[model samples]
Target: MLNRIASFALATLLLITLSACDDSNPAAPEEPVELDTQTVEDLPADPTVTVGENGRPQGLNQYTFFSLRDNEIVLESGTEARADSNSTAWDIALQGTTIRINGGTSGPGNGAAYVAEAAFENVVEVDTERLQPDTEEALAIPTGSGNGWYNYNANGQNYVRPIPGRTLVVRTADGDGYAKIRIQSYYEGAPELPADRQAHPSRYYTFDYVVRTDGTPSFE
Candidate 1:
């Protein structure tokens, strides 16, 4: 009728001008995910043990009993090696990378106060014995008795050796015999050593200790 109502209002104004045309060609804002970083030449220049961020193992790792705070070091036995582990009075606390000989005591000789509960095991065995848990007849550790039974400077006897990729086990409550020595000497980036039946481990960066005949002490 009036030209079909002006052609149906011009087809509803061209379908509302193509639905307010921006026809969606402007949707490009999504690009921000680039995180991949590791530089110390990408780590492991000479690493053998690394576990940092306080899960308690840093730099060089090995532990049996560790109680730490900062960068502490206390290797006791008449002390004089200190990084301040409370200036220990030799109650046997080999601070971090663990070794703690603490458990029970009543009283006896050869300076009593090391009675029971200090077990450790690694195991291989080749028959060896030496004791002085206070004395009886379980001898032969006299390889040059600085007062044998492991002539002390704190149990390791001033580097007759062990610590190259170390594994040490020592105990002598007398005839509870244990000594599998190593560590010709050490310090300065060392780790990864095996194929040692004694050669030139004399010292370059030694931190080696070998004591096979793995386990002992079970008074039950």
Candidate 2:
């Protein structure tokens, strides 16, 4: 009886020791999701029905919805984009100079955004604390000539251009991760010098972005 009890105690002690060793060295965390820089060109943001005298989009007011996760245009039509505006299928929406995320007053998703003054490549990590969702009073990405991501009639060029050193850091629609966007041009074909208003259509977006789906905040 004494021998059996001693053996049982010894076995229990060994088991406990093994369990402690296992706990000390937990499994390594899974690797963060890998993503590549993606460029989206000529994404129509409510292509104008007519060019005004000032060389801006006139009439046919609408928004083009885009999905950062899917990396595709979710909705391009005015009616369809509005109908699905409440859904999380899209992460961002654009119309003229206005940009919207899929959170707050925009949609039901957890999307949020803030414009970073750093260059796109220089922004290696996301500043999650500064992010804000769209609100009725104001948008996460502010609009206007000198505000947010663009400058209107820059250098008296008579066209809108993305402001240099301005990058958009966004909390993805699902709120699972983050993304960074650098708008290269606001004209069709991403012309180097969009001097001719008629030749270079307005409201078309050319931008590059990188998205991480693993919830990591670092772009590297």
Candidate 3:
């Protein structure tokens, strides 16, 4: 009996020691998602119906009104445009990416953090009616005032730089569809603004984004 009890105690200690030494590895972190980006060009300075170099009134990238005045891209609705006598021809604005309906009175709001995508394809489709405004997933666009929206890099060259890989996703104001956007630049031709010329007539917003018409989460 004594011998059997001693053997059982020894086995119990060995089992405890083995269990304490078992170190399971922790889980791996999730990979970041990649979103598709779209680009628009020569977005006019306002809804003045300026004859773009392409000789066309600015088409609403799915918007009823757009303007690049007051150092801000003011996105108003058609009714607001008509009521205020503003042009209802512009679509997207650069200060990051903002959109409003034909009659909306405000620009995109600071609602929520934009959710990045896993993978998306770039396109030239500016269908706003199908795109939804996501309030929770919006980001502020970079402007050319003060610190503006970009960081100045002095390491390689004194150049105005953009926040790399920063983006936003928004649901349409009506809550029907979705759109993803990212600011590419605040200057003409998406050129890097010179550090010496910080106030060089900003409000010229260049960006890439995708609009989803199917109301699904997939923006690819």
Candidate 4:
């Protein structure tokens, strides 16, 4: 009788231990939330004070530092931008037609970028190997008219316009997140006819972007 009782006790103890082990097992991790696309309209990038005779904006050579994570302009003045230039608070900086990411010679952040030939919405993934940080000799997003994001004086047009089908694939300030940007208009209010300098003021950036902050390359 004692032997049978001992066997029963042992079985009960084994079952209890098994149940405890099952209860202690950790739960599976939840899936990361998908990020949404964000649109920024009329984010001023230091509007020019005068329009030159050549129909190009002149004067007010200052950069407007913007944060993609915050989706806001962090600094608009040259002095303030210079003071915070080394920080990662701002991801990108724009002055006239020139755009600079936060990495390399531009700033202290890990920011980098590359101009993709694909359409904005079609670019669902980023190739991190192709990304390049800003440098004195060359920029990730090249400067000059047709070389980079915008085309200057294309087809005899005097005003600058974003090159169609070109999208900017950017590594955020933290270097962990990624974002894709499509420049809709460089003029304020995103005018239908951006070449009409009289009506459409230049240097304002209106763009659509999708940011993924979960440290993933997927923009979806």
Candidate 5:
């Protein structure tokens, strides 16, 4: 009888010890890491881009050329220019007259297109993971006007232009992913202000973009 009682006491103590251990060793909560696509000192941040800045970090100088091809961003300075392939030749291109994405047969998978948003500042998150090809919101922007992608106004003193304030949500070519682009400038390496047209040589584009290559629509 004493042995039986002692066994029961020990069992009860074991149960209590187990309970204490459970309470002391709770599971750790996971904290999600946020991703940003902004260029750092003219380079990409991480998991945000396979290719970082395609142009100079200080900014693209006049006539500099850049391209996004095969998941790599290439930048070079000089008078070299790329002819339009009209086929996803290059995923995207920047020149004096236009900022364009590949479309039609030249595009990847289904081809790439974009829809303009009110502004980049209004964007909080991109639903990239679930994005699909030929989304209804996409539009094939044209390179008609030399100022086709942006406009500038001198509010008496400063030259105001649409850049980060003008955002494009894109369905990338090959139907692989989604990217958000904010065109910062179209004149010589993306200068902040629009100087006198005669004073600034236009055509070079400086921009920022975040791409989600996972076929998802999330940019964050």
Candidate 6:
């Protein structure tokens, strides 16, 4: 029995030595303490509004300078877009010179900026004695398509020579906003003969008008 006890003691000592050998290397290095790194992503604003980089105004406006300069008036939003210009954008709902001139665009998609057609004749002031108040819209596209005059008439009787350096006041009849549209119109090239569809392909005399705004107009 004493020999067996001595043998057991020897076995226990060997087990301790083997266990110590498994962890013999400087505390087993604590699993190498790995540091983890994380990543993140950035996103844009709300998902409702459509954002396009194709010349949309700096402040994300729907209306641009080209839109205003090309047409006599424009609504800021595509929702309330009226078709007056003969371009592809014109729709049947806005046939002829049907600009409401309310000075704003209406609809769900309207952006921050709105543009109105800058007229060459906001106010047509002619000498009263020679008054020819013709309400007919003289749409003269002598060399034109994108922009021309409409709903404008000669409010004087006798046509007078355009005075040099004379500024006339044109205004927005729907509101206080107004601009000078024309200075004078006259005969040019050849007298255009009335036609069934097209105005006899001849250029007529027309007086140029100017636009006054807060700053140089912009589109995109």
Best by lDDT: 2
Q: Write the per-residue lDDT of candidate 3 for residues 1-220, one digit (tens) a residue.
A: 9999999999999998787767444467886345444566535433323366788645333333332112223443222444322343323333222333322334332222233322223322333343332233332222342232355543556454555544445544334445666656655556666444444433355656565545555554
Which one wins on TM-score? 2
Off by over 4 Å in 6: 1-94, 97-99, 104-178, 183-193, 196-207, 215-220
- Better model by TM-score: candidate 2 vs candidate 4: 2
- What lDDT, from 0 to 1, does candidate 4 have? 0.86
lDDT agreement with native, every candidate: 0.29, 0.89, 0.43, 0.86, 0.49, 0.28
Among all windows of ten consecutive residues in candidate 6, which has the lowest summed lDDT? 38-47
Per-prediction TM-score: 0.21, 0.81, 0.41, 0.80, 0.56, 0.21
Full candidate order by lDDT, most accurate first = 2, 4, 5, 3, 1, 6
Give me the overall lDDT of model 6: 0.28
lDDT of 4 by residue, 15-65 (tens): 999999988996879876767889999877767477888996485778888
lDDT of 5 by residue, 1-220 (tens): 9999999999999999999999999999976545456531222211111233675223232222223324444433333453433345345544333444555533343445444545765554654443333333543544342233455553554343553454666666556656676766555445666567545444445566666666655554
Quote model 6's TM-score.
Answer: 0.21
Candidate 4 Cα deviation (angstroms), residue 170? 0.7
Q: lDDT for model 2, on a 0 to 1 scale? A: 0.89
How far does residue 199 in candidate 2 sit from its true spot (Å)?
1.9
Q: Backbone clashes in each candidate structure, one number apiece?
A: 19, 0, 17, 0, 14, 23
Worst 10 residues of 4 by lDDT: 77-86
Error of 4 at 56 (Å): 7.2
Location of the lowest summed lDDT over 10 successive residues in candidate 1:
37-46
